[model samples]
Target: MSNFVEFTFRGQPGYSEPTAREVITSSIPVRTIAIYCFDPRAADAAQAVADYFGDEVYPGDLVLDEADRKIGSTATVFPLIVGGGRAADALRSITVSQHLFGIERVVVVHHSFCGATSFTAEGISAAWKHEHHTDISSLYDWDGISIADFEKSLNYDVSLIRNSPGTPKHIEIYGLFYDIGSGELTEVVRDVPAKVA
Candidate 1:
């Protein structure tokens, strides 16, 4: 009974959940999910990652149907932008992406001179307490709140993603540091699962 129900796949007549899922899977060939910061300077992070992989397509053209309705995209890399490019915020996205598009790689890129690096966990927590009158010290993990060191933060995020139950064991996870000024990516950590015998 919602007015916008017609826009959903399930709302279409004779289209079941399974059918919709299959249609979506065939539409976009997403193989990698790039998690990066929301900063405008970092907007090209997805394209950079795609270029680094040499097989992915970023900002690909959209596919249109006979009626000129948008059907899908030719892109292979899906960018998940979040604060600090933290794995904590991208956990659910990884799970959902795998479920929908069957992603093979998860890339976490923390850029240089990021706002997340400007404050400490303690400083942000205390500032929030004074400004918003709420104690957010316990709301999020201290290490995940801000980036003290690029290597440590990237390693922590990669480890966090690897240990999450929602993350498939077969998925390859990578932690990278992006120098915004240089537009260069340095691999900090990479966790590729062992091949099953």
Candidate 2:
């Protein structure tokens, strides 16, 4: 793939010309995804599991991760192991990536029977503190933030990214929920933070 540039149906060289067997998803990969999961060692580790599906795992580096879809043209997936809760801290931190890296969007995916989504906000905050060795004061609120809340938060986060001095200010954020039981990824709000795995 070419070096990360923009998102769209970027498949042909001529813009009007077409190839005989052009594969999609190469031209347009995912933006960024924040996940709430059972395993703490996400991304790289999870990708080891996901390798059965032919996915290359991008580990540790958030902005450099694909799905992050920044400078690298390859599709990347950044996994923040916010175990068993709404990854508000994870979401907040990802905004920093979007601002830092020129990523065009964000996606938050929560699963149907996820251990993370089953917990309370208090539980999540406590876990975040314990895992990150940080206090609770450094994050924002996602207590009421759900798949339905993506639209509102997307606009808000986009505003935050734009308003932040020196940020690229043209990126879009989205939120989504994936049904693990049904194996279906649902779009909760368009252009909002995704809560998918």
User: What are the TM-scores, per candidate, against the unseen true structure?
Assistant: 0.98, 0.42
Instruction: Put down candidate 1 lDDT per residue, 67-168, tens digits, no spaces.
Output: 999999999999999999999999999999998899999999999999999999989989999999999988998887699999999999999999999999
Off by over 4 Å in 2: 1-31, 39-73, 84-87, 116-169, 192-197
lDDT of 2 by residue, 26-125 (tens): 3324344444455433323334322322443344332344466453344455555554324444556565555434355444445554453355556667
**RMSD in Å for all candidates:** 0.8, 12.8
Angstrom error of the Cα, residue 70, model 1: value is 0.7
Error of 2 at 69 (Å): 22
Full-model lDDT, candidate 2: 0.45
